[model samples]
Target: MIALAGAIGTGLFLGSGKAIQRAGPVGTLIGYSTIGGLVICVMLCLAELSALAPVSGAYVRHAEYFVDPALSFAIGWIAVYGPCVSVPSEWVAVSTIVRYWTDLHPGIIIAICIVVSFLTNIFFIRVFGEVELISAMLKIALIIGLILFGLVYDLGGVPGQSRLGFWYWVEPGAFGEGYLVGGGIGRFCGFFSVLVNAVYSFAGVETTSIAAAETKNPRRNIPRAAKHIFVRVFVFYILSLFVVGLIVPSNDPHLLTSTGNAAQSPFVIAAEKAGVRVLPSIINAVVVTSAWSSGNHGILQGSRSLYALALEDKAPAFFRRTSRWGIPYLCVIFQSSFMFLAYMSLNSDANTVFGWLSNLTASSTLAVWVVVGTCSLRVRWAMEAQGIPYQELPYSAPLQPYLAHVVTWFSSFIMLSGGFYVFVDGHWNVSDFFSSYFTIPLSLALYLGWKLLKGTSIVPLEEVPVGTFIAIARANPEPPLRKKKGVVGWFGRFWWD
Candidate 1:
């Protein structure tokens, strides 16, 4: 539930309003669904890998044993930074949410959220899980309720509400006025602009895979969770957008002009149009909870990745230290501190920093997913070479090798092309472009440099250490049911207990 809550946050509620503006409802919805599919593929890959390894540092450990050590190092470090960056962003977002209810200072809200998030991290796992579960449940309930309400409103089933079916799409012609289409290629560019934002909305669906290590009965639980996650996210995201488009025209004055306002959620706007009273405040509260949830999960994932890096000797030794509760204290502290630092941007103009930071993070995330897919492919090959019984694996990803290669290459292409959006759109400042786009190439350089310094080439399948290989392949304990099956031959005749 924590993973679901964190997955559905500010990215869809607040950030996607701008995406609707750029891509129109139809284009954006389609793009989001496509990205959701990509995420599902990645999740399947991770699920199989994690079920085999079932460690706290799910992807980080997978990379180390299957791919180049330097790839693991780069992925681990970036994973640590990813959540830290998100923490401050969530605080800032929560501050914005608070401002809707009161004129209290943003700084006060930011400080309070930071302290609360910090405290949450310091507590034991169950406490953290409880908070996350509640937050996730609330967000899920709100989204589901909102979707149902919108459908009723559209059907004129609600009191005093008129039918509002498909008007927004037709009048806007699916692209809105002033949407330039210089040539065939230019139209594709406009569509691509919307696609990027849709992709970003589906970014954190993989958070479930990050939770694989800590989940009880992960062999069964993780795979079930992953399947449900993909279906839920896709339905929720695409359906919400479709409903929003039905009620609120893309050219609605509020959304078109209120680019930087805190109350710019399309959900809120749609609710208002549907005669839902006090909707803004309700959505605002949900948004705050969502942001906080996002931050909590972010820190949890980051710390685990750091712990994995330490285990692989790719990060500082302190990160490897686990408390009695199996929490990596030092790594958590390191990640939380970075998140606190991200809050420094709140001092600047909110819109500018938010756009820049979001773009950077989105690009970086895509790059990381690509690497994960690549590593999964390598793990597959390594498993085959070692004569591992692939069919006996607890979780199997469908369309092996091909899907992995397609997703890895596709994500890499998108990561490389992301920079051009800033340039061609002419909306991004030079600083924003550099900060957002350069992270991809910069990460590559860092990985290569580390490999050179450490004298660690990408280990061939034959050369990978037997213990390390076994560690990943044999991480999950055999289930009782499986154990029972193993001794069941002629069991009816023997009747042995």
Candidate 2:
């Protein structure tokens, strides 16, 4: 539920307008579908690893055991840095989203959100799952409602508006003349730009793996969550975007306008055009919850990652300290301090700051996925070199290391190309370039610096300890899966056990 909920937040509710504005509806669909497919493959690979190890830090730990300790050190910090920026980015989103209703000072809104999310992380940490579960359910409901509303508006089901059915696509002709060019070149740029935007939306799909250490029956549940999440998130994202395209024109000026609220959303614009006066406020309200929920999730991921590092002696020992509830109180406090960065939205255009932060976090996310793919590939190679049958694994993902190879290279490609527009003759911007591409070099430098300092080497394929982990799994076997009975059983399966 956390993974499902995390994937549907600010990027879809707010930032998607940027995508629709850059690429036309068809281009947006193509880009999201492409990224969505890649995310599914990544999740599949992660599922195999997490189900087997179910360790703290997920792939970060997998790297230490299956790949190299230096690799783990690099990826672990990347994980930490991702949420530091991403959490504030969500806070900025909340501040802007609150603007749909009033001129409530963004700082006030940001402060309240930070306080509430921080408290949730520190005090009610045990109930974090319940809080996220409720938030996820609400987000699910909102997306479904918005999709249905979009379909009705597009088909002229509303009283005043004429049927819009694919009118925008036909008139705008399906593709935008993209950044810095025209015709075919511009169209390609436009589509590629959508890929960059879509990366942020799909950034957190691997949370199932991240939370594996805390989950019950992880060998069964981690893989189960991965399988379920891919389908739900894919359907919701594609359908919502497809419906938005049908009702709202890609060329709509409002798509580019930053109102810091639902007014900037394509669905909200479509609703207003259809004479649905109340929908903007409703959408804004739900979206604010989504932003807060995602921010809270960032705290969970970031703090746990820091705690994992301390557990491995890669970070300061104080970060390993926990409260009676096992909450990483110090780590949470440290990660929560980044919330002050949200105040940047007060001094500058909230939208611009958000764009910068999202780009940085998006690139960081790509780097994380690249590392994850590498770790998974190492796992498979170890199995082969050590002569362990696939059946010895807790769970085996289909497509072998091929999917791992494709996703790793593709993620690297997208990460590097994220700032391509900055290279155009008239489009260069220093901040934009750094935000889009800095993570690449930073990650490389971290890996190289640690390797040189510690003299660490990548573990050889034959010595990766696959047989040791398999023996551990066999010795402490999970309880056998059992069938549930009656209506409650049906309900459990309908959602989750």
Clashing residue pairs, backbone N/CA/C < 3 A, model 1:
none
lDDT of 1 by residue, 218-273 (tens): 77667667777777777888888788767767677766753346666788788777
lDDT of 2 by residue, 1-497 (tens): 88777778888888888888888898999999999999988888898889888887898889888898898999999999899999999999888877777888888988898899899999998888887899899999988999989888888899978888888888786875464698888878888988878889888888778868788988888887887898889889999999998887877888767655557778678778888788888888888888888988999899989998998888899999999989999999999999898898777788889988999889999998898799888888889888898889988888888989988999999998888989988998998999999898889998888899999999999999888877877887788777699998887676643
| Alpha-carbon local distance difference test for all models | 0.72, 0.86
User: Once all C-alphas are superposed, what RMSD does model 1 give against the true structure?
Assistant: 5.8
Q: What is the alpha-carbon lDDT of model 1 when measured against the actual structure?
A: 0.72
Clashing pairs in 2: 96-260
Question: Which segments of candidate 1 are over 4 A away from where they belong?
Answer: 123-126, 178-187, 211-217, 318-330, 340-348, 383-393, 425-428, 464-497
Best by TM-score: 2
TM-score per candidate, in order? 0.87, 0.94
Worst 10 residues of 2 by lDDT: 255-264
Give the clash count for each candidate.
Answer: 0, 1
